[model samples]
Target: MTKILIIGATGMTGKSLVAEALSNGFSVVANGRNKEKLNALKSEFSGIEVFNKDAFDLVKTDFEGIDVIIDAFATSPDQAYLQIDLAAHLIALLRNTTIRIGFILGAGSLYTDESKTQLTNDLIASDESTKPWRATPENQVYELEFLRHVKNVNWFGVSPGSNYIPGKKADNILVGNDVLLVNEQNVSVTTADTMAFKVIEEIKNNNHNQTRFTVANG
Candidate 1:
């Protein structure tokens, strides 16, 4: 079995990744900064190893036996740029080795159309109702851009659609490259369950090396 480590394993999407990867019989480790939540996950799920350490503090030894890493780490809007910082940090750690890296990318980076641009600019310009959370998507876009130039590490960035609801799997999942995917009702959404399944598939397949992909529910 492939030994995998998940960063931000206490978040909603991270929890789903743990559950789905366990169900698929992968050797999984949960990494997070919150011991309480990590303890709760341990109590709720069997066979999951937990590591309570800050992302910035992780050293190469921590990844000694890990085959793949899922970067599901999240931060507050005020500190959203940490997303890029963590990506850089992890990239630096895994620079020449074969250990693959995966990311739960932000939806704001998805292409709004064939114009070859993304929605982060418009989202940043939205009204004050979304005032407190704009920096997150802004920083996520920066993270993806930085990862695009990395040549040594095996990386994949999976971006969820417009409405990313962190819950059960949808009946069907739609996959796309760079573009915003829409269902028949023209709504763009991706559930945490579906995202987990797709990510684990990518981890196993190694089909999307150093590329960014998007997912939605149809």
Candidate 2:
């Protein structure tokens, strides 16, 4: 069984990844800083081993015996820069190693049109209703920028659609390389479970190496 470690396992995406990995018979090592949430996760999935440590403090030794590490780390909009910092830290730690690193990024990094206009620009120009959370997506865009330069470690990035919500798996999914994905109804959304399933499939298949991809409900 491939030993997989998920950072931020207590978050919404992280929890789904944990469940998906376990259901597929992978050995899961869940990492989170909150002891209470970690306990809750352990209760929900009895078989998973837990790692209680801040992502910034994690050293290479902590990843021993792990084949893949999924960085699902998340933070509030005001502190969104931590996203890039964490990605850099992980890439530095795993440089030149065979361990595959997967980053859960936002769709802000995606191109919005054929001209390659990034979605982050439009997001920054959006209305006041989205004022507080804009930084989160902006920082996620920066995170992807950082990863694109990394050439040593095995890395792949997964970006959810415009509307990423908590829900069960979708009946159909559409994958894309860079531009934001939308369905015939002109809806751009992805359920947490659907994203988790696709990500796990990529990990198992080892395709899309050293690149990023986006997904949406079809």
Best by lDDT: 2
Candidate 1 lDDT trough over 10 residues, lowest sum:
116-125
TM-score of each: 0.96, 0.96
**Cα lDDT for residue 113, candidate 2:** 63
lDDT value for model 1: 0.90
Q: Which stretches in model 2 have alpha-carbon errors above 4 Å? A: 118-121
lDDT of each: 0.90, 0.91
TM-score of 2: 0.96
Predicted structure 2: lDDT: 0.91
lDDT per residue (tens digit) for residues 112-149 in model 1: 87686557446554757777888888888889999999
Total backbone clashes of model 1? 0
Candidate 2 residue lDDT tens string, 1-60: 999999999999999999999999999999999999999999999999999999999999
Candidate 2, residue 160: how far the Cα is off, in Å: 0.5
